[model samples]
Target: MQSATSPLQTLLDLINETLSLILRTSLTVRSFAGRWQPLRTKLASLQTSVADISDSPHWAENPLLYTLLPNLLSTLQRLKALADQCNDTSFTGGKLHMQSDLDMAAASLTNQLRDLDLLLRSGVLHQSNAIVLSHPGPGSDKENLSFFIRDLFTRLQIGGVEFKKKALESLLQLLEDDDKAATLVAKEGNVAYLIHLLDFHNQPWVREQAASAVSLLAASNDESRKAVFEEGGLGPLLRLLESGTTTLKEKAAIAVEALTADPENAWAVSAYGGVSVLIESIRSGTPATQTHSVGAIRNVADVEEIKAALGEEGAVPVLLQLLLSGTITAQEKSANCLAILASTDEYFRALIIQERGLQRLMHLIQDLLSSETLEHVLRAIASLSASEPCARVLSSSTLFLIQLAEFIKQGNSILQQISVSLLSNLSISISDGNKRAISSCMGSLVKLMESPKPVGLQESASQALVSLLTVRSNRKELVRDEKSVMRLIQMLDPRNEAVSHKFPVMLISAILAGGSQGCRKRLAVAGAHPHLQKLAEMEVAGAKKALQRLSGNRLKTIFSLTWRE
Candidate 1:
């Protein structure tokens, strides 16, 4: 009793005791011979007591030492039953089952891991408890040592494919927690292994859990992402999106999400028709499936053709339906899809309104106004409104300028983008009521010019302002609004190419709006800006002269600067 206890000693005791309990159960099952003999009574007693104690919430608070020994024993009993059912003879020393050896080993390994988890969670084992637990050390700590021991032992015992799959799944149950998983993946160099499981393992859960690990690994850094894809991660995930169980589909969705995060990843998903599968998953999968599918698709929507494919895939109808009938998560998917697709051409915009998409959007708003929807309805609404065509809908007899104005006043960034978009649509020139709505939106437009922006938002604002400038009347209004002009000038640095192009024209418009003197000065400055220097010369020289000049010294300078590195 006076003896001091060591960490390794305590861990060994836990492991040995757990193994002893497992041996006792296996021995009893074997000695009884009959699957349903007196031993069945003993088994029933054990399982009931174990479940009763484990299910108590307070059990997590005060973990009893060796408490997990019973669960491990029970789980081993379960493995024995599974083995017997399958005619698996694999047992102590791997002798009982020959043909079934791998399967039996896999099942027992899975159950054993389950037992370890219970012990660690109950705090009876003072180990670095996370199965996928990360960072075994502040470089030197007691818990870290435990994790190191557990992970080391688990990896050391890797067996056949089936056995490895079960063990990996149990490890994932440990690593799903981001902190632990991040650490575990780093140490194991598991990136390549996880990618392989997506293809080699046939069981849905095994691949599903493996996908989760892969996703985590890929999300860690460029090195892991490259390791996974280099090992053929992309193709298997696309295939799973086609036919796997919902759980596997979600897992695949997550992996796809991780792989496609970097712009480089967008091409990977794009290469083998990945976009088409993701779109279909969003349109037709279960609610949970759609949530993840939409997330993956959204990650890479920056590529335009991919967005158009998403639209033509009948994605809008299903997304709209989900918004109407599914959960809050479903509504979010629907809205996000709209936001992504809103960047597409006007045909879809006309389809959205012609198909009464506008009415459904308004109805969604009314329901939230009427009951329990997420306030992000306003965000989805703004995406729709961002299409100039959607502004036409806002000006519809059924909609209101005030609501659009309110969105400009208070909607989130996505909504603000669409609101500015709707204002830009004023150039379409509709009815008397529409004109008044457009004018009302003008004031709202001025308001958004002054608000804080989300990432890439100011670009959307800039394009809307530039689009508005083309409208003769709207130009005068925008020009008169000093706040709007200043904001556009500031947005010369927008992330979008189209918006960046708008800068020159909008800058000219702003100067002209400032008066004749302002316009003349802008013209001179435009003449001086590097881009303008050539344009001024070309304009004075005509098309051929401009072309020749650009192809001369300017071309050399451009090539030398870009090619030098």
Candidate 2:
């Protein structure tokens, strides 16, 4: 056991002594020149490898290099002894026996050379050159951190099970907050190695850490996500979800979710039969696992084929259960998944209603404080509202209608848009009673139509008003609010290109269909007639129809008479 202070020096001294002994033996015993020749060549190569290692200031700190040094020294000592035997003139052993001993010595030298070459090629020594033992502070040298990450990758490639596990744990720490390092790992193609460890047999802990590392990398950036998918990460991740421990399943679900976030990688999840496993995870996994699994399903369900697969795999029931009982994240994710499914297929929408998914969603919406969860819940309800039967059922809930009206007025822009769209859908089947109740949202809808940006929100608000105004009571609600009616007429102005002329024209037509003279006179006085004439000339839909209805009240005579006045 040489002191670490001079281990390289000691190894170098042993190599020189061996080389000197080999020269003496080669000159003394010309009979074994063939064997000595190759042995000398091997020792020279090993010497060069040692010199390379010595060039790295941190080679002494490399655990693999330090461990190999003592064995290398011992091999040299044995070779020197064998060389001394070959130089002995009065040896009792015959020439043939001496030849065998020389051959054995040559073989030992070849093994040492091979070991040293492997050490150099492992890149461990070079990577150790950049090792920074202390935790990096703010604005530390990112290059050093990059080299340290590469060193861990080298260990993963060649170290034993324990070393690989420690490297994975270290990698997870590095990736925890350092997205740049994760990008580096992906660019270096090390994510494939991490994916390989996910299937490490009989080493659940190793696989756990590997899964965690992959999950972190997948979530880090688009590059890492694409890397994981390209490396076939989804297959092993699915297997973990199928049979791994609770913790492993949770980590694997997270990896799957992140990997599928890139829609390009989503089809592979279903290709690997992940849909059923993820649905089952929602049924039986831990709260965290359920959340991640639901999120993964939501990401993949965007693909039409995956949506059908989720339906066939009976995800609706499990997701509805999760929507009711899982964690807030799980509930949000489940609602989101359900939204995708219900939005795409009419059968899934009906299936969700049959499963009482609507009831659960309506119940969940009441207590949800997270805007994200509420958004998904509203999205789910909005999708279900597209079904006439589901609309009738949803409209029957007074509490639900009140909540929607409030969401229209008070929710964020996205929530406001979704709520408006839901009301628009509900208006098709809404009973006469519900229509009057939902009309309370008309003021907010009119206000939404006034904003110039997010033209889609404005369109959705106007479209809902058109549907609601088909009911006489809703028409009265609009007619009673002069500002609301005036805003619709203002939108009809061709110079106000912020909104299409069609929506405002449609709203006025729905109003005039009630045949209220006061509404017609109000429109005549508000100068709606000229706006409609210009819109009709432009051939905007519904503008001609609104003009005809407004003219039917002899508003043509009123307009001409007012012009003369």
Candidate 3:
């Protein structure tokens, strides 16, 4: 006969076995051939069962464990069966259709395991309900965590420095792993409490923790973020960034980043003299600090007034420095900010070019980085290329020209559009070398126009084509390609009368300007004449001219006839 175990010991044994099953099931399902939708449903159901058991009013009582253990065991049995089915080789069809669902299921199972482990290991379940309300460790019950936070919120104003610091630290921790808990903390008025702490707390660690907490809490909920700005969080945050220690400055920058996520917060940031403080942080703080500072600036730089303020405060020189020397993240942020600033103001664009930023950007593109980083680099370059001096520099660089063409063919859609726009600028006052490079890529441009890309891209691509057609040789090359005339005809959609009526219409006129009979016949056969005539009725000069050119070719052919009359 076997001896029966104590109730606590039996419950602990059940928890350990349940955790083992979860881990083993996760592994088996992960290695299965079929998609894990079946496994995901099983795990989610198991997690829900555990949550329901935990949420029961009698959950904290030891006697209830005996009652709940059978339900948990039943769930575990079903989960194991489902896991076995997932691993069954006899199942058919695609093997990885629901990878995302499988991933989410795994995470859910892991969280449940942690919660159960916490429930068993904490050893706090007594007949009496007088457990100590201390800071929560992993998998602490939500009720306990919320109670602990409520207690701390009461102490935040009147507590000693050490107590206040501890409260802020605990609050920051609770917010990190659980958004629901973060919401509770914010709803308890802890955000307002922390903002006050950031302003008046004498201890550096307290302010740092407070700033850190504010950042997370503000970002967690829309209401919390709005509350932070409404409660005057910007001034304290800016002051922290201005004079606090490096760690405090880093934390303050985080809060500022979150605050600026709302466009309305930008004004508060600038009004509180954050422009100067953020620039200083970027210049002097560590790399992480620089990244956050630049993020804050990027959020605000879109506002023209703030942009001029940053420029007035000499942000350009320091931003250029960061672009050259900072970490990869910092360089990315710096490039993004410079792109916006330069795009908004021509003076800033010229300044960036003179500071050798353009040359660095060219090199960055050639480094073959990710598309995201390359997009920012190209954006700044595109803006710079619009300036005559910068255009000359970019056009003169064979490397830059080649990279732009490569981007057009292989980059994402936005990158392709930007590349074509820059090419258009380069083609203006284009040197013969630049024209040759661009003309070599005429096929790529025509393909872009034919793609189902956005109308803006088609417009830009057509503009670049128009500029390239300025060269007589390029115009002849366009007519020689069969797809070019068809593509031009496709662009003459009455629905898109804006770009269709303008740039594509101009392109057809230029191709016909070469007066090739074959090109004219191709356009007519492609049914361009009707669309062109429609444009001519609308008083589009280019359309009228193209129709006239095509009509002249027809008249010439008739006059050359030797028919009997």
Give the best candidate by TM-score: 2
Q: What is the lDDT of candidate 3?
A: 0.71
lDDT on C-alpha atoms for all candidate structures: 0.54, 0.78, 0.71
TM of each candidate vs. truth: 0.48, 0.76, 0.66
Question: Quick one: best lDDT, which candidate?
Answer: 2
Residue 25 shift from truth in candidate 2, angstroms: 13
Q: Provide the lDDT at 309 for model 3.
A: 83
| TM-score of model 2 vs. true structure | 0.76
Q: What lDDT is obtained when candidate 1 is compared to the true structure?
A: 0.54
Please provide, for model 1 over 131-186, each residue's C-alpha lDDT reduced to its tens digit, 9 standing for 90 to 100: 34343434445455445435433442333354455556555544454443454445
Taking every candidate in turn, the Cα RMSD to the unseen true structure, in Å, is 16.0, 6.2, 21.8
Per-residue lDDT tens digits for candidate 2, residues 266-343, read: 888778988899988888899989999999998987688888888788988998888778888888888888888888
Q: Of the pair 2 and 3, which is ahead by TM-score? A: 2
Residue runs of model 2 more than 4 Å from their true location after superposition:
1-5, 11-51, 54-58, 71-132, 155-170, 187-193, 201-208, 304-309, 385-388, 395-398, 451-463, 470-474, 529-565
Off by over 4 Å in 1: 1-157, 160-170, 177-187, 202-205, 218-226, 304-312, 346-356, 369-392, 412-417, 427-565
Evaluated at residue 173, the lDDT of candidate 2 is: 78
lDDT-wise, the better of 1 and 3 is 3
